[model samples]
Target chain A: MEAFVTLDAVAVPLPLPNIDTDQIIPARYLSRPREVNHADFLFHDARRVPATDEQNPEFPLNREAWREAKIIVAGKNFACGSSREAAVWALFDAGFRCAIAPSFGDIFRNNGTKNGLLPVVLPAEVVEDILAQLEASPGAHIHVDLPKQEVTAPDGSTHGFEIDPFAKHCMLNGLDDFGVTAAYEDDIAAFERRYGRENRI
Target chain B: MSEPSGPRTLFEKIWSRHRVTEREDGQTLLYVGRHLLHDGGATAFDVLRQRGLKPRAPDRIFATPDHYVSTAGRKLAEIEDPRHREMVEKLARNTAEHGIRMFGLGDPNQGIVHVMGPETGLSQPGLLIVCGDSHTSTHGAVGALAFGIGSTEVAHVLATQTLWQRKPKTMRITVDGTLGPQVTGKDVILAIIARIGAAGATGHVIEYAGSAIRGLSMEGRLTLCNMSIEAGGRAGMVAPDETTYAYLHGRPYAPQGAEWDQAVMHWRELPSDAGAVFDTEVSLDGSAIQPMVTWGNSPEDALPIDAAVPDPESAADAERRAQMRRMLDYMGLVPGTPLTDIAIDRVFIGSCTNSRIEDLRAAAAVADGRKVAEGVLAWVVPGSEPVKRQAEAEGLHEVFRRAGFEWREPGCSMCLGTNGDIARPGQRVASTSNRNFMGRQGPGARTHLLSPAMAAAAAVTGRFADVRRLVGG
Candidate 1:
């Protein structure tokens, strides 16, 4: 499950920090059962105003160029609250292949990686440069070389991406949560067989 | 004598012992020994009523409301917000409707769900517990296999008292050194996260060990256990030691006399042997940590008291660079700005993260004989009403009031924005609570996550400053 990993497609500048899980997928969405089409929720809170009919001023996704963004370039400490894995599920389910940030809260990082969402941390200057580049050329795609660990922008430029060796291992295998647990299947079974019923669990 | 190859790390002993049925795919259908309930949990009970399913074992389930209860509006009858009042009303009605033990609002036994659970003995050693709250892992310090479940899974536990879980791998983090003055369990966990980066412990159950952990009080251990989620781990724990036993003695739920002695004997045997090995081992020096603060959105994006905000240029990863710029813009923080010079408009001193009595005492020491800065909007919200009353009776509230801080009642309060308590847009707040991501306090507000003492100092200074400096330096 371990290998060199890199992805560079489009630089989607979210340009916001402290984007919480509630904003990513509002709590009311949780009241509803899981569904395949949760992408509308990406900016439900942002798009609440009435003038949003034509302008859609209320949704974060309403930003024209960012509507189909698969790569998110965001501010420091993204996803700092809540332990909801659904936040990541919604992002991945929405079409985010990779998310570049200065930092992510502990639970968000784990949840993002657990679901195969790549979170790349770089120096703030380098991230800004990418944001500037995206502004210069909207809909630009970059080439991410996982083996080389670099992201090559639309202008034929490149930048390095750092990921923990372990997380990289999980993403490359496409294992996510189920994959990690399967590794110790034999021991888990043996333990349960010996102590299962009498435990009155 | 047994070979010392694998003496069974506490994580292994607990994880291996809890499995009931394992599918070939590796997920386990494990029976839950206990389920600690919180306000967020009443929704599950409501679902059960709608479905007409009775909980399989009422004795194993426990309920308390910490998230939605109003700290200021204690009397349920006085709550003006219909939604907030209805939530509390639902909590009371739901607990009784389900036959679950109810720690209704204003009950002496009522407090933060995690705080009251262990204090009351329902969260004992060797048991597996689950709650809808992430901090449910706090019970692991007592040697229990506890973790948080989602709402749907919360419903499953409510009905069948079981969870389908995939076992986590093991991570052993040992900090073997003396903690410096003013450093705390909070500092230790923050330091670990900063040192390893946020994803260092993902997909693993971390067992905290060595001198630093052993030296912690039971409450300190719980504080450390509480931040396991912040460390990207499924859970964190320390084996029950003498401190654990001492804290558990004479509590309403703990075993007494002969039963207590027997329980102690079993608890004493909880530690791993000298030669025990783990799948992974990480070590740290405790002395290196200082009173820490999260400078960026992530818990790992932290630095010591006197440091410059991270320059985006120093970010080595492409994704990192992009995110750094966004965070700085939202926070209105300029790169190269000295963290010490960053002024705060508000200082909030409460949350499940740092609202306990010990936390209050620590903050009070900073507020004693001092007053908040002219423009700082400060608050002292205790974790529970009992804590608030206890502080008031002890004059801790006076210390806070003397410091020009608003000494408020119990409830989640401003830690979350749901209670109509939030900072206005563009307000910079030094918070003693956890999760300082942009706008976490309210729309357009910037938060700097700090220790409680640090929050007090910030209140007095109206800027990020060291609490130790106020005393002498």
Candidate 2:
């Protein structure tokens, strides 16, 4: 995991709600090994024309100005279905370090945190303001400062966000749950020694 | 620290038991009681290897090959797709290397991870269960606190047998009154999703209670809990009762003899006490729920079978109306078309949501002597090899085959378009599987989520038909 403190990058606006994992990275791409570049399959069904194999012109990702955006501003309940972490990996693989939405699927949100992909929850109105700003100026950049727990808009106005303090701590230190659990190995070994005698697998 | 007391919800009791330590920041480290792994386990195993770690408590982990295994009756070596074959092979290799027990493909104990857990008694009241699939809430039917986690979390559990967590608020969903004869558990859940939008239960662990819920069989309870994730719930639970105990009394992994008596004594005390207050409360009338089916590309876009497709103009908000229009366009459905009259190209009667033996029996009764409509591609995939054998022993397979439906092996076939089983492009399918998102069954495939009986009825009629009417009940 990479430590995430602050990111200043162009924000892409995808205003649709309930963009589920199936749409993020289809199940068809799930069989491949972890090393496969999953970014290519991100929104495979929605982004490409099935008949012509060309990028769908209507999709915001296909717009030239938003092509390189590193932060995604989406509608409510983004990444809503399935527990596939491929969704987060695909976003990270595609160079998106942050996604701001009104809400997110529980597992998707957790997966993002574990992978250092910051999923920032904001009020719907605040998200709308961000999207509005992005629409007004296609390549506008937003700054997210994890240490400060604030998001600064292109106009220099700042909005506060809430994240679990432990999650924030882990993100700042590039730590994972495994690393945190390793700290208690002595206690775990003690419990296992006492409990293992009774229940043998 | 002192205990705050009034009455605790079931979720609170179970969460407290599993809590190992808590930080001032409101995050707790929870000791996982059991971990369920499926073929997706391979990916997490790859991560473990990358980190140069071994499973800390391999005894606590159980693995199975469900998602990527071919359910077309082919031997493991004969799997057509090399990628799918490699996934199953990797799972076998990893589980073996870790010395973890696996109910591999063709193992009688093997089935959909959710179905196999409770059937084998690996799930129990008061335990905290985690799996890599969203439908893991199915195990909560046994009164356990279970929810889906991502692969990274799976690897974390492999390394520590614990999860870092913030406790979720509790919601109580009370369904009262008796269901009509034709209605099943699937209808109950669909009705709940219809009443509450997909995200209505977000950030909450829902504890289902009330008369109707208590009246359901263990399988029905599982069905209700299985789809809780679809409604954005972190987990779904039903308090342990006689029904829960009877189901776990003698299963392979259940406590036995004196231990069993002691376990029941503890489980009997697991239900929420009177006057317990939930963060949110929702109640539904069971009798009013009909044989339900989804009309658009969301589980929440559901209606009674007799109802017509919704008109976007009737939506309360412009954004919802636009969403309705887009979903309708993708589903190729017209507003006001009677749900029963809409045609279907396929009928799938399997998935964690509706693949138990009871589900198979219900579908078999519908397809008993009826011939499937020409051009309809129908399949009945059992939940597990044991379920498959039980259905065969009861001749349920014969009924489905006689009705022109293909009787297949146990796996998640045609559920999410894996392992070469998928509805063709532009095809509309009536599926017992949970989700109906666009391309969920296959690219350009339209899915109308329904119960097994409704799916079987569609197989015979070539369109969505009221199961009650088909059976003349």
Candidate 3:
């Protein structure tokens, strides 16, 4: 995992709510191995014309000015269905370092933390403001600073956010689950010695 | 701070027992009592290889092939798609190499990972279970604190057998009174999702209680918990009782003799304490819930079978109205169309949600003497090999077969459009599976989520018909 301290990049606005994991990376793409790059499949169904196989110009992601956006501004309950981690992997592979929404699906948010892709939860009004700003100026930059737990808008106004401190620690240090668990190896071994006796296996 | 008052809820008791250590940030490391894996386990294995890490306790992990395996009665070697075949083969090889117990294609225990867990007694009362599949909450029927985790968490559990977590707040959803004759667990859950919007249980673990929940069979209980994730719950639980004990006794993985007695003694005390308080509470009248079905794109877009499609103009808010309009557009449904009048192209009676023996039996009862309508195609794919064998023994397979329903092998067929078993594009289906998201069944496929009996009714009638009306109850 790469450490994420701060990111300053263009923000893309997608205001639709309840954007589920199926839409993020459909189940069809999931059959392929994890090594396969899934960015192309992100919103594959929504982005393409069913009859012509042409890219839908109306979709936000297809807009030329927003093509290089690295932060996604979305509506409430983003990534709401299925516990697919590939959703996060696809967004990361597509160069998105952060996603701002009013809320996120429980498992998808957890998956984001593990993969070093930040899911920023803001007030609905704040998210709407950001979306409006991004819509007004597609290449406007948003600054996310993990240590400060703040997001700075293009106008230089800053907004504070809350994140799980441990998650923040892990992200700052580039510590994946293995690295975090390795810190308590001795305790884990002790637990095995004590509980392994009665286990079914 | 003063000592807390009132009795602890079942969630509290289980959570405390599993807590290994608490970090300063309010996150605790909880030991996983059991870990279940499926074809997706390959990703975790790949991560392990990349990190050069060995599983801390291979014995604690169990693997199976479900998601990508073909459910067309073909042998594993005959799987046509090399990618799907590779997924199952990779899981088999990885489980074998890592010394993890695997229930492969031909194994009697092999089935949907969630079904295999409890049916095999690998899920026990008061245990913390985690699986790669979202429907893992199904094991919570046994009073376990079980929830789904991502592939990265799978790798973490493989390495440490523990997950770092922040404890979720608790909600108690109490369904009162007895269910009407035609209503099933699927109806109860759908009703709850309808009552509370999709994100109602967000950030909370739900404990289902009260008379109606208690009256359900183990299969019914599993069905209830299986859809808890649809309501955005982190986990869903029911306290262990005589029913749970009876279901587990003598199963291959359950405790034996004296140990079983001791385990039972502990489980008997696992119910929520009399005065336990929940962070949130919601209640429903079981008798009022009819055989329910989803009309729009979300699981929460549900109504009783007799209800008409809701008009977008009647929505409480603009956002909701817009959402309804989009859902209606994607489903190809008119606002006033009666749910029972909508025709379906296919009927899928399978998936982790409703592929158990009881589910199959319910569908079989509906299909016993009735012929499937001419234009409709129906399939009954059992949850596991054991479920398939049991259904065959009971002549349920013959009943379905004679009724023009396909009796297929055990896997997640037609649930999420994998393994070459998908509804054709532009087709509409009556599905017992969870989720009705666009393209969930197949690209451009419209799904009307319903119970197994209701799905069977649609199969026989060529349209959505209320199960109560079809069964003449």
Cα interface RMSD of each candidate: 6.3, 1.6, 1.4
DockQ of 2: 0.65
Sorted by lDDT, highest first, which candidate order results? 2, 3, 1
Ten contiguous residues with the weakest lDDT in model 3 chain A: A192-201
lDDT of 2 by residue, B57-116 (tens): 988899888888888764797678888888888889999998999999777799989989
* TM-score for each model: 0.79, 0.98, 0.97
Give the per-residue lDDT digits (tens) of candidate 3, residues B29-105.
Answer: 88888999999668888888998988878777887888888887648876788888888899989888989999998
Error of 1 at B113 (Å): 1.6
Q: Second chain TM-score per prediction?
A: 0.95, 0.99, 0.98
Clashes of each: 26, 0, 0
Best by DockQ: 3
Q: Which ten residues in a row have the lowest lDDT in candidate 3 chain B?
A: B1-10
Q: In model 1, which regions exceed 4 Å deviation?
A: A1-23, A26-41, A44-60, A63-81, A85-201, B1-5, B46-51
Q: TM-score of model 2's chain A, to 2 decimals?
A: 0.93
Ranking by DockQ: 3, 2, 1
